[model samples]
Target: MMKKLENFAIQDFQNDLINWYRNEKRDLPWRKNQDPYKIWVSEVMLQQTRVDTVIPYFNEFTTKFPTIQALANADEEEVLKAWEGLGYYSRVRNLHSAVKEVNECYGGIVPNDPNEISKLKGVGPYTKGAILSIAYNIPEPAVDGNVMRVMSRILSIWDDIAKVKTRNLFEEIIREIISQEYPSDFNQALMELGAIICTPTSPSCLLCPVREHCAAFHEGVQTELPVKSKKKKPVPLQMAAAVLYDENGQLYIHKRPPTGLLANLWEFPNCELKQELNKTHTEQLALFLKEEYDIEAALQPLIGTIQHIFSHRIWNLSIYFGEIKSMESEKLVQVDEETIKQYAFPVSHQKIYKMYKGEI
Candidate 1:
């Protein structure tokens, strides 16, 4: 059972938070309108990404696909192109699939009901709550990391915020106290407070609007209330990428498989270096070319190495410039810069391309 909040009035807390929000909230682009489609896009983009980075992406995305129907009508490649720099490709794919469903089934209107909206692809509890409360003014708790941080400090909860059960506990607490008349601003205020004031380290407790109700602040433990378990280290991987050039001066590129990491994006011909291939990078490239593509190639000196760090993997990529001597298969295509520009390349491959063009 959850403990009841004490020593402070809920009504006063709500008023203070709402008043501070009205005066101090950042003028984000998504706040300019209450359109559900725009709001949903912003919420998805803001996941695992900073607000400043999301601003340009949100603006470009809205400009291209202003309406749900427009997004549904766009090709998957076009949508991926628009989301090129955004690391999480699956979000864009799910958003694209969800918009298509909304366009066909709901006449391009984002459903207001929580259950109906949650049924869409990639629409989790938090996303559903955000869309309903922020766009439609529904009284639902949007418990993201920020909201959990703020609530954990206010109530002085000691549970591990990283655990699933702890998140559910926070949700229940929020549902009980969330503002009914102004759910949008109320939830945004909680998130904004966590982002700027009740931060993970060295929180600004003195400047807090609802400091009187902050149990952790009174106990002088605001920074330590929201406990989270440590994450495991990312696995390191070594890779070799070959920038193959044909006699016609066209670069060889291939599309990734339809699913898994970096699905459907184009990339330079590369292979992970296994323990068995203990040869030098150039020797490995020669072997990979002969075995995978049945092509005879001569690898030039190592051009450079590009380091790309994903959430769970760190790729140390060694790039090599090579010329195709003879071809025995048709697995890879040779394309010029103009043709390659039409396809979305993963950021790692993009870095190699920039190096080839002397841009980096």
Candidate 2:
């Protein structure tokens, strides 16, 4: 193990790695400085999003709110608006709470201590360690999926890397290498390699900076290392998404409840369209919607169909765009632009509604 680990310590190897990074590393705004607030925002935005996809969003976000106080002072809608289309909106909600926690509880100052930051809203172990190392240079390592893969292949560990046991093993090793000197830069280097070179599908060993020290690479088994269990198949779900437009070109939209997947977001009027109805469906659906919500009006034709795939299921979103022919005219309620500007809408709807925003 000691012999294998020396590959990381070789002076030429480390310098080569850094030099390669200096030339190839992306010029992301978040990597420009050690600002904790900016780093926190980047980490949250990059949770499940790719780095390329997150770059513009990070720039827009930082430009909007440069400091913790700015973020805390911003309205919830504004925060969610900034986070639209990025998905997994809870991260933004957690960010809002976390920012407020810093302002109200900590005098609007970012905490220097990792454990103290962890206690704040939405901070987990990985996040805490990241903040500690990057923002404050406390020498704590942040072990995420990328770090796990890089570490497992380097040490040739055969254990299930996804399990808690493997995490513990890596944690001990991390503590050993963690240093007050050059802490954040070191961890970032390891992560950058894992992300770009030692990728999951097709690892570019030839481009890897520290491949000489990687046990999996030396033994020609890099592809098979860091095994994970096969994922379960995604289930199919059904939903009816209705788009209502009046003759004036104004569209009717509804606000989602302030919790769950897309909290406090405006959306097209939608309901779970069960699969039980077949050729005898139209009448049953129209009646159900009427009775269920007082819409009670009959639908005419199917306008469009959208397939929205989420982490768990595939939603066959059947959208019906129709005009209410004035049955009682009570179903449609009038809302002003003030209400429209106060909520966030799911990115899917935003994509669809961009065609209609000007008209509305």
List, residue by residue over 1-360, the lDDT tens digit for candidate 1.
345555547788999999999999999999999999999999999987999999999999999999998999999989999999887888999999999999999988999998899999988889999999999999998999999889888887888989999989988888888899999999999999988888889999999999998888889888787889999888999899988997888898888888899998989989888767568877877888899899787888999999999888999999988889988788898899788887888899999999888888
Residues 114-144 of candidate 2 have per-residue lDDT tens digits of: 7689888778777888888888888887888
lDDT of each: 0.90, 0.75
> Per-prediction count of colliding residue pairs?
0, 2
- Model 1, residue 22: C-alpha shift (Å): 0.5
- Model 2 Cα displacement at 355 (Å)? 7.1
Residue 151's lDDT in candidate 1: 87
Worst 10 residues of 1 by lDDT: 1-10
Candidate 1 residue runs with Cα over 4 Å from true position = 6-8
Query: Judged by lDDT against the true structure, how good is candidate 1?
Result: 0.90
In model 2, the clashing pairs are: 265-344, 290-296
| Candidate 2 wrongly placed segments (more than 4 Å) | 1-24, 277-281, 325-343, 351-360
Query: How much is the lDDT of residue 315 in candidate 2?
Result: 72
